[model samples]
Target: MPKKLPEVILYTDGACRGNPGPGGWGALLIWNGKEKEIAGGNPQTTNNRMEMKAIIEGLKTLKRPCHVKIHSDSALIVNTFTKGWIDNWIKRGWKKSDKKPVENRDLWEEMLRAAQPHKLSWFKVKGHSDDELNNRVDALAVAESKKF
Candidate 1:
């Protein structure tokens, strides 16, 4: 019989004061009723990079392979992962359909690699809603961004 895997839930958010200015990432990781918060920032970065970083950090926290549910408010992040856009990029050698260079290919590729060891489901949640965890992550991201 297969070993029982831990059920993990993660809520992530990213923020940027300006489009290409101060940026931060936040995540809330929950397992077996316990929760852990993760956050970071960069002085010069984009919101999308922060979003990808949040997922990358959250996944890296896992000790071993397990089932993971990732929640995000960014449609670009959720759709790109769930709709297989990343795989398409990989197949096309990290180029988009238009054959243009993929922006943030580094972070996206790192996120993809970090995600490979687990069973992941990407879910989209409305931002600034009543979701407590999501709101918490938003706050964390904002706070981190302010530090820059």
Candidate 2:
């Protein structure tokens, strides 16, 4: 019989005070029914970077391999993973079809590598919703941004 993998649930969100200003990333990790919050910020960054960082930080926190469900409000993050954008990026040597440089390629590559070890699924959640955990994460992210 194949071994059973533990289930891991992650909810992530990112906020940018300005497109290229202070930005924050938030994440919620749930394993074995216990929940943990992870969040951070950068003084000069974009929303996409924050979204990627949220996932990277959450994955880094895991102690062992597990099946992971990632929920994020950013369609860019969710769709990129789900629609094979990262694979295409790698195949093109990190350049887009139009031959433009991939924005945040470094973080996107890191996110892809971090996800490689797990059975992962990406889900989209509505931002600014009333979901308690999601709301908490957003608040935490915003608060963290103020420190930068």
Candidate 3:
């Protein structure tokens, strides 16, 4: 019988004072009863970019392919993957249904590459909610944004 792989749970958040201003991202990764926290910021960027960056950085932490469950409050990120927008985007040469180029193709491509090694499930959580992990990452992201 094949060995069972352990599941990794991740919670991520992002914040920006303005749509195109100082932005930050935070992520919490849990695996095998252990937890890791990661965060960073960009001097000038968008909230959506920060959100995707959090997921990208979180996935980069794994040493090997594993079952990953990613939880985020951003509907953009969740829906893009969960609603099959990503697959169609690739098929349509990175253009949206409106025949416009995807706004964050670079980040999306990076995310796809980072995610390729694992079996992933995306979950959308309510932002500013009572979920402890979600709140923690949100706070972390907000704090990071304040640094610059």
* Prediction RMSDs, each to the true structure: 1.0, 1.2, 0.9
Q: Please name the candidate that would achieve the greatest TM-score relative to the true structure.
A: 3
Query: What RMSD does model 3 have?
Result: 0.9
Question: What tens digits encode model 2's per-residue C-alpha lDDT throughout 1-148?
Answer: 9788889999988878888889998999999889999899999998888888999999988888889998888898888888998789889999988999999988987887787778898888888987777787788778877887
lDDT of each: 0.92, 0.87, 0.95
lDDT of 3 by residue, 32-76 (tens): 899999999999999999999999999999999888999999999
Provide TM-scores for the models.
0.96, 0.94, 0.97
- TM-score (C-alpha, index-matched) for candidate 3: 0.97
Backbone clash tally for model 3?
Answer: 0
For residues 18-103, write the lDDT of model 1, one tens digit per residue.
98999999999999889999999999999999988999999999999989999999999999988999889889998999999899
Kindly indicate the candidate among 1 and 2 with the higher lDDT. Answer: 1
lDDT of 3: 0.95
Strongest candidate by lDDT: 3
lDDT of 3 at 35: 91
Ranking by lDDT: 3, 1, 2
Q: Model 1, which residues run further than 4 Å from truth?
A: none
